[model samples]
Target: MDFSHWLLLFCTLLAFYNLGIIWFGQIVVYPLFAKVGAEEYITYHTFYSSQIPLPVILPGFAHFLLPIALIFYRPEPVSLGLALANAACGLLSLVVTVALEIPRHNRLEKGGKQEDVIRELIRYNWPRTFSIMGSAFLTLMMLMQAFSPTI
Candidate 1:
């Protein structure tokens, strides 16, 4: 398939993969840690704080690449629109990750107050969640356009 098509498919898979991170963090990982005593929670928090940068930086770089690729490919209107929308959502997620989440993670890493860290984490995570869902929706729309007889 064309580059636009390939980028769309790549984004769809990436968004779905991110959804797994969201689900696992929200449902399994956080809750388990949250249930532990405060000391344990703090320790867990500190560990994760150190680890967070790797995930964020890698995905942020990938987010940059995807949009550039979509723009370069220059698909037809319907496909292009869908790809652009998906790219926009990915950009939004990247912004939220860099602007909001990374700072919080950095603070936590530095030995900032736990309450503040947790609060920021909770606040910032929703946008990432929504962006992933938006990417999925846009991908579905693109697929329909791609396979539709009229298109």
Candidate 2:
């Protein structure tokens, strides 16, 4: 009904959007990397890498800003601790992306379909996937708390 609520909704939407993408990557896409024949992997990976960034960067950039905004402008009933917790979940996703997952993606892109790399990609991906999932839940809870009228 107001700016804080809107902020929470937008942040929640971004978290859910990222949650869907990451889960799909976790459950379907990453594991399937090994099945692609080596010769075709580069091409497949190229296409995948190209297509992925828009989905990632658009929300990612806003996702970055929104959590910081949450820290400052959290709605009624969304405590400072809850806001910080939501931001931490977002931070975890970012740290995992910048530190772990991106390198593995680049390795697969450059080195072709190394099974070890794919396996590590899948293995390393669990944290980001679940954190975004956690982010989504945190945002939802924030919304419910903001909107609900007592008990």
Candidate 3:
């Protein structure tokens, strides 16, 4: 209802949104990178890279910032520790994305879908994927703790 409440809802929604997208990439999209034939791989990957930013970057950047906001504006029943944990998880995911995943993607983009690069993308993605999963879990816990009926 207030700022913190609104932030919690937004953060929770974003957490699950990120979780879904990352999981889909981990389970489906990244694996299929290997299947895109060498001939079409460049074209397909170029299109994929072009289209992905909208879905991936916007919510991801929002998710990154909202947790930091949560540290300052956590809703009722959400402790400072929980807020810090949420922020940490978001940071971990971002670090993994920037440090580990992006370079692999860059390699694939430049080299035109080398199997090693694709494999690294999938393998290096685990930390970010798991961090998102952790963020989702923490946000879910916060939501329940904040909104559960007083008994």
Candidate 4:
């Protein structure tokens, strides 16, 4: 329909897609990498260092922008609340990424003493994972509001 509508749909789709990435990364990918021993661990770290930032940066930026679009578009109050909640989740994701994840990733890439890096990665990753889940929830709520009867 309009920009806000399109933005909501896009945000919903992307958030869900991002959720899939986080889920797979946490459940399958990271665990697999973690089990591969030190050399493979280094390789996994390097690969993740090079590739993960792409997914993190763009979708992160989009996640931030979409909520602002919804706010600007001034949707219904229910829709606005849903959008704000979604945006807040994105903001939390950004905070966790900046405050925790990226720093750990940087340390992993630097090839230094990683005595606590894995532990920290495991710790910090959970909040980011939960934030994605929260975003998915909010996005679904927004979609419901977008489609549901205005009562």
Clash pairs (backbone) in predicted model 3:
none
Give a tens-digit lDDT track for model 4, residues 15-39: 8888888887777765554465665
* lDDT (CA) per prediction: 0.66, 0.85, 0.87, 0.73
Tens-place lDDT per residue, model 1, 53-89, is 5664465457535754665564454566667777888
Global lDDT for candidate 3?
A: 0.87
The regions of model 2 sitting more than 4 angstroms off are none
TM-score of 2: 0.93
Better of 1 and 4 by TM-score: 4
Instruction: Please give the RMSD to the true structure for each candidate, in Å.
Output: 3.2, 1.6, 1.3, 2.5
lDDT of 4: 0.73
Q: Tell me the tens digit of each residue's lDDT in model 3 across 14-107.
A: 9999999999999999999999999888888888889988899889878866899988888768888888898999999888888988888877
Q: For residue 105, what is the lDDT in candidate 1?
A: 62
Candidate 3 displacement at residue 25 in angstroms: 0.4
Instruction: Identify the runs in model 1 with alpha carbons over 4 angstroms from their true place.
Output: 30-46, 49-65
Error of 1 at 15 (Å): 1.5
Query: Which lDDT tens digits does candidate 2 get at residues 75-126?
Result: 8788887789888888887888889988999999998999999999999889
| Model 1 lDDT on a 0 to 1 scale | 0.66
TM-score of each: 0.74, 0.93, 0.94, 0.83
